[model samples]
Target: MFYAHNFSYKTASKSLPGAPDLDEEDSLEDAVVVFFHVEAGDEDNRKGCIQKFVKNTKWLCGKFATKSVLLHSFNHLSGSKSSPEFARGVLDEAVERLERAGYTVKTTPFGYFNEFSIHVAGDSLAKVFKEF
Candidate 1:
C-alpha cells in the first residue's frame, strides 16, 4: 500500500468514529474537520465529481449520521491565507452538497482564513481513499 507517514494529516478516531483528517483542533464541543480538493477539471466533470462525492458521502453518513457535515474545495492549494475569494464562491456549494446528502451542515466556515476545510464526525471513512 502506498503510505506517507510524513504526510501532514493528523487523525483521532476515538472521537470521530471515522478518524477524519482534521483541519482544526478539537473543541469542548464535538466535531471533526476534513479538507478536500476539487482538482482542476471541466465544468461537467466538476459537477459530476460533486454529485458522485455527495452520493458516496451520503453512504458515509450512515452511523453517527447527524445533521453535521461540511464541504471545502480547492482548485489548487498554494496557501490557505491568500484565497478568500475562492472560498467565497464555493463555500455555498460545500454547504449545499452536505445538506443535500442528509446532513444538517453548518453554515459556519471551518478553520482559519483561506484554508479549505470541512467538518465531519465519523460515518465518512468509507469515502476516504484506500490502497489495494
Candidate 2:
C-alpha cells in the first residue's frame, strides 16, 4: 500500500541540511505538494504502483491548474514503511515523469528531517488524500 497526502499551496519552502550558498534550498508557489509514503508491499509491483502514483499526482495537479509539483518523502503516513532507498528511488522516478510532462518539480532532501513552511489555499479541494 501507498498513500499520497496532497495539498494545494499558495506558497511553500523547505530548508535544512544545506546552506543557501549550496543552492540546496527550495521555494515554490501555486504548486501541488504531495507528501508521498511508500509501503513495503508496494515493492511487489513497483512499476505498476509507481505508475499509479504518477497518475494520481498529475491528476491532482491538474485539478488545481498548476504545472508545478513538490514531492516529499513522508513515511509516517503508515507503519509498514519501504526502505529508504526504495522510497528515494520512487521519488526520483516520479520527478523524471513529472518533468517529462512539462511540470516543474522539486523534491525535499531525502532521508532527512527537513523544515517546511507551507501556506495552503483555504478550500476543501486544497487538501486531498489517496491510498492504494
Could you say which candidate leads in TM-score? 2
Report the C-alpha lDDT of model 1 over 1-132, residue by residue, as the tens digit: 011111122222222233334544322122223345443342335455555655554554453343444443332344333234434444566568776655665422333334222333333342365211
Model 1 CA lDDT for position 88: 40
Clashes found in each candidate (C-alpha, N, C closer than 3 A): 3, 0
Candidate 2 RMSD to the real structure? 5.6
* Model 2 / residue 20 / CA error / Å: 16
Q: What is the lDDT of residue 91 in candidate 2?
A: 87
- Residue-by-residue lDDT tens digits, candidate 2, 1-132: 111233322222322334232324557777888888899998897898789888998888877788888887777557898877787788889899989999988777665556566777766777888887
The TM-score, computed over Cα atoms with residue i paired to residue i, of candidate 2 is 0.79
- The C-alpha TM-scores of every prediction are 0.44, 0.79
Could you report the Cα RMSD, in angstroms, for every candidate shown?
A: 10.9, 5.6
CA lDDT, candidate 1, residue 67: 44
